[model samples]
Target: MQNPFSEEQVRQLNEIGKLPPTEQQAKLQAMFSTFNEEQIKFLQNQQKAVQEQGGQCPFCMIVEGKIPSQKIYEDDQVIAVLDINPATRGHTLVMPKKHYALTAQMPDGELAHLFMVVNNLAKHLFETMKAEGTNIFLANGAAAGQRAPHVFVHVIPRYNGDGVNFEWEGKKAEDEELAKIREQILKEGFEIKEEVEEEPEEIIEHEFEMSERIP
Candidate 1:
C-alpha cells in the first residue's frame, strides 16, 4: 500500500511541480536533507504500514498502559514521553492527559498546561543532557506534519552540528503583503492574559534516551 501523505506534505509536493525542472530537483534535495535514498524508502514503507494500521492514535494507547513508553513526566493534565521518531538526542513529546484531536480543539487551560510542561522539560534536557539548543514543534493539522490526530508538542534538544534543520525555502513579500498579514494576525491572534493560575504539574526525571523516548 502507498503511504498516506499528509495534506501539507501533498501541498508541498504539488508546489514542487510548479518549479522548473532544475529548480525542482534542487528544492526536493534540500527538503529531504536529513534522509538518504535508502532511509527515504524505508520511511515510505514505514509510513504505509502505520497508515494501514487503521488510524490508531498510538499516544493514547501509551497513556493507557496498552503501549509501553518511558514516561518522564505526568500531571493531572499532561504526560511526557520520548518520541519514537526523534529529531535529535533527548527529544520528548508533551501531550495533554485529556484527548484533544487538534491544537485548536484544546482548551486554553489545557494548552497552557501542556506548554508549561514542555518549557520545563526542554530546560532539563539542555542542562542535564548537554543539549545546546531546543526546538518546540507543534502541529495543528496534516499540513503541519502531524501524523497522529492526538495533539503533541515535540521538544527536540539540539546539540552543535545536529543534522536537523526545519528551515523552509524563503521568499520575499512586498510591504503591502506583509502589512496585511500582520494586521490580520494581530486582529485574530490570542489575547494575553495577565494572570492564568495553572495547576502545578508533576515531573519525573529519567536518565536515558532509549525506550521510545529519545534519539
Candidate 2:
C-alpha cells in the first residue's frame, strides 16, 4: 500500500530512523523532519479549525457520528476503537468524548473518566484475549509522536513471544532537583487529588462493571 503519510512525512520518519525498539514509540522525529513548509501550514490550519468549532473536533466528529471509525467500545464519557494500523493483535485506542489535543488540557473529571475506561478495557483485553500483558501509551506533542492533535490513549496487547517491547532509559534525578520539582508540584495544586473526593466509590465500581461487558 502507498504510505498514508505524505512524502515530507515519510522523510521525517526516515530522519528519526528506527526509534529505540523498546520504546514502541512511532518514528516521529524522522517524520517531522520531512514535513515541508506547506504541510506544516496545513496542520496548523487543521488545529485552528479544531479550536474554532469545538463540536467539530476530529475525535469529536468520530464520537458524534460525523465521522466513521472501527469502534470497539463506547459510553457517554469515552470511546474505545480499533486502530486503523494496529501494531499488535487486538491493539485499540481509547479517546475521551471531549476534544483535547493533550491530556493536560482535559478537565480532571474528564481525564479521570477517560482513564477509568482505559483501565476497564485493559482488564477486558487481558481476560478475553488472554493477553500476556498490555501497554498503555500516550504521546503529547509532535515531537512525542502525536500525529493527530486529538488526545487518545493506546491500549496495545502483548503476549509471550509477541516481539513487542517498551523499554526506555530513566535519567537519574538529583536530590535537590527532585525536591524542587516536588515543591513546585505541591504549590501548583493538582486536580486528580481534589476530584477523587467528589466522586462516589460506586461510580468507580460501575466503571469496572462496564469493563466486564466488553468482549
Best by TM-score: 1
Local error of candidate 1 at residue 25 (angstroms) = 30
Count of residue pairs whose backbone atoms collide, per candidate: 2, 8
lDDT for each candidate structure? 0.70, 0.69
TM-score of each: 0.63, 0.59
Question: Model 2 over residues 125-166: C-alpha lDDT tens digits?
Answer: 877789989999988766687867578999998898887768
Worst 10 residues of 2 by lDDT: 197-206
lDDT tens string, model 1, 104-181? 445567787788678878888887889999999987655556666578999999988999998899898999999998
Q: Candidate 2 clash total? A: 8
Clashing residue pairs in candidate 1 are 8-143, 82-213
Candidate 1 error regions (>4 Å): 1-56, 183-215
Provide C-alpha RMSD values for all models, in order.
12.6, 11.5
